[model samples]
Target: MRALIAVATAATLAVASPLLAATLGDDGLHKTDWMRDTFKDLREDLAEANAEGKRLVIFFEQRGCVYCTKMHEEVFPEPVLSDYIEENYFVVQMNLHGDTEVTDLDGEALSEKAAARKWGILFTPTILFLPEEVPEGQSVSQAAVSVMPGAFALGTTLDMFTWVNEKRYELDGDEDFQRYHARMIQERDNGKTD
Candidate 1:
């Protein structure tokens, strides 16, 4: 009887795993277990993220964004990708067209929409990956290690997350993100997902 119950529990978890990735907030943005709730100050947020031994990630999305919904439903729900992100990143959500006040790293205060514009974010679901150590006087965008715009497939998103988390951007190799992504694709095709 105990063995049967254990098997049933495992089966239930297998079926429910994907549905556990993302949840919709009252504000209409996707929320997950890993996203942080902070005061929207980039400097303080960076400090907090570094203290937690994670890289800071800024996620931009607008209300009623189809791509954002698709990402929350499809790509982010994948356990490998979601777990990687949750383990390595401290995510902060920003509304593309919101009035929330955000303090830039350089001490500039602006509304969320204005800040997004200042950072040259022109799309929904843009993810700005920050380095662990940012310079004192730089803005968030100016100090970002990599900026991922738009939604991507599981392989691409996972590759990007891994590359940034591994600090591959700081490497002196000629293999840029494009090359790294291609290599990841090949590895996946060869049945090595990691």
Candidate 2:
């Protein structure tokens, strides 16, 4: 009976492996190879991201966040989304309630939780996209070019990333995120975009 149970457990684990693929780091946040482990200094992190020819994106999450888990497990691992993010964005994970020290863009050092509060981050899995050139003395919230405040499907998430990457936010008149996303969806449906 013991041997049979062991074999069944192995089978179950094998079948369930995909659901377990999002590995948790020691800090309890989901870990990805593309997530750069940094000192949490926003200014230095931004500079480093710019040096890499990528946008700096801050991901705010907390332990046991269901939406965070959804993105990690269902969305991020998808090659189309993951590859784009890994190639075009430098991702920094911030714990919504963690005590880890983080330096804000304005040179204010505070705990991760405090930084979240200061940034007015009210939702888990919020993604803040920073422009390449942030004015001096600006806070993260003020400097963000785009802020995705809640969970979204792959298409919406990918569109947000693409819009930011292409700097569509800077375009004059009627090409904001909503319009851009609508265009993308239409193109995708018409087999004009991936």
Candidate 3:
């Protein structure tokens, strides 16, 4: 009887331990004060970023988008990527199909998902890097200057991250971002560090 009781106790603890670990890990992943979970809040966060002199990185994603899940699970959790993002950007997560009210910087209330449509955010996991503030009287309907759609590998993602961090878009003119990106790849392969 004593042996049986001990075995049962051990089995219960083994199952409970995994459950406790999973809950703790989830709690840790969501333990940031500035992480916005909705599109509306994310738009508002852009203004906060502008006020704080931080760049805005808006991640537009849709339900059932495998690439979006991959980005969230793989890219965002990467230690180096997370560190860079936390240091340089105000990150915003937006659901492409959810209906929610979003207040723009100008205090206009619009459907958050509708605004995404107006901005041509048709793809899942589109990342927009906003370096400058939208002008006071300007509209959010304007297209982002830099948009990267689809999933990206860590190397490509890191390259883009560095380029945006250093403001290379200002120097590379008329070649388009893809061409500039290619140049970066070449330079990197040649052991050139920028």
Tell me, by TM-score, which candidate is best. 1
- Once fitted onto the true fold, the runs of candidate 2 whose alpha carbons sit more than 4 angstroms away are 1-20, 191-194
- Those runs of model 1 whose alpha carbons end farther than 4 Å from true positions after fitting are 1-18, 191-194
Minimum summed lDDT over a 10-residue window in model 1 is located at 185-194
lDDT string, candidate 2, 1-194, tens digits: 99999999999998776643468988789998889899999899999999999999999999989999999988898888899999999999999999999999999999999999999999899999999998889999999999999888889999999999999899899888998888888888684543
- What's the residue-level lDDT of 44 in candidate 3? 68
Off by over 4 Å in 3: 1-34, 37-44, 105-107, 141-143, 172-176, 187-194
Give the better candidate number (1 or 2) by lDDT.
Answer: 2
Best by lDDT: 2
Q: Cα lDDT for residue 140, model 2?
A: 97
Q: For each candidate, what is the lDDT? A: 0.89, 0.91, 0.65
Model 3 TM-score, 2 decimals: 0.69
Q: So what's the TM-score on candidate 1? A: 0.89
- Give one digit per residue, the lDDT tens place, for model 3 in 136-157: 6445545255777889976578
Question: For each candidate, what TM-score against the reference?
Answer: 0.89, 0.87, 0.69
